[model samples]
Target: MQATQPLVGKETAFITGGASGIGRATVLRLAEDGFRVVVIDRNALQVEALVAELVQAGYDAVGHAVDVCDRSKISALIDAEARVDVMVCAAGIGPSCAFDAISDEDFRAVLEVNVLGVFIASQEAVRRMKPGGRVVTVSSRAALGGGGFAHYVASKAAVVGLTRAMAMDLRQRRIAVNSIAPGFTDTGMTRAMTPAQHAAASALEPAGRPAEPHEIANAIAFLASPRTSFITGQTIFVDGGKSLGGLGL
Candidate 1:
């Protein structure tokens, strides 16, 4: 581990699903670290609020409301000449049932958000990124196995596959791609879990607690930073040692 420094200031980062959760935390972290952030989210109001907050803090940031699952919209978003230097594919969904219990519609929706969404965003970003650009996608420890939540797990496993594949394709271009698999974290995404369920999950972690959104954000920031240019095709686990705690969530 090295002391991290702000990358080239003129560089820009386009973050997807950046209105809340780990995405928003990454946006704030990147902006504060002296990178211009371009935030995209489905919630226009929340995106606006984030932009306003960043601007008030004297950070260079902007917000755009676009569905990452839509290819055309994603293409248009990255069509600018800004030439983004970093992309954080934090846009995803996990509120799904078990494989047999999930409806066709629900299963497709999960893949759309977790798998296809990352592909589209990465494709669009790659087209506009400089040679040394960085890309980091949010995955989950659930992807390691198919337990009760099959749909979510499968989708996230796809993310890890995509990360490795993209790294191979972009190696010649010097564009690094990686994924972060976080365990249970305290965020809007986990807010829906029953208190008892949350407690059970927390107890499973060797740390005896869940992680904060900022904790995950810090991992992502490291991957996106220029200091990590040599660290590609790796799935860095930020699960408070949970991945080593028997790999169950």
Candidate 2:
């Protein structure tokens, strides 16, 4: 939460999956930072409501209902925008399915949203980004290890690789690409876990609890800041020190 004023020339930011969780928190934060914000998500009603809240709060903001995997819609939205200085790809899902029970369709579905969805958004964002622009994507700590959810782990790991490659590809253009690999964050997705499951997971974190949505959003804002110009192609883990060991190190 830096001072609520324009930074790096009042740049405009586009965020995906902005209806809730980390995405929602980031939308409000960047707006506070004085960027003209555009929130894109597949949830139409939620998007509308969020935009209305931002508008009421006096932030230059708009909302669009979009499935990130739909390139046509994404292209149209980016094309309509005059400039994009920051992009945050926070749309993703992590479902827990035992490897033995996982199916092809289910696996692909996760990849479709978590992996391809991010790819589509990042590709489009890179195209519309101005020089010095920043792109922050969401990965997961599970990417660093073999987890129970193979599909989720694989897809998130792909994001880290994609982010690094994108950082290299976009360096010539002076646009930085980075990722935040959050650990055990308490969001809607985590809330879906049963109390017993949640307790068991929370016990594993060195911090002994899940992260607040705003906590992760704060890291995201920092990475999206022009101040982080020297930072690129790295995945900073915001996992309450969970990465220090929690699972089979």
For model 1, where is the 10-residue window of minimal lDDT? 1-10
Tens digits of per-residue lDDT for model 2 on 1-249? 111233334587888999899999999898898778889999998898888888778888878899989999988887766677888999998899999899999999999999899899999888877789899999989998765799999999999999999999999899999999999988999999999999888888877788888899999999988899779999999998877774652
What is the alpha-carbon lDDT for the whole of candidate 2? Answer: 0.87
TM-score per candidate, in order? Answer: 0.93, 0.93
Candidate 1, residues 1-249: lDDT per residue as tens digits?
A: 001222354778889999999999999999888788888899998998888888778887778788998889778766642557898999988884656788888888989999999999998898777788999999998888756678899899999999999999999999999999998888887888889988887887778888998999999999989888899999988988767756663
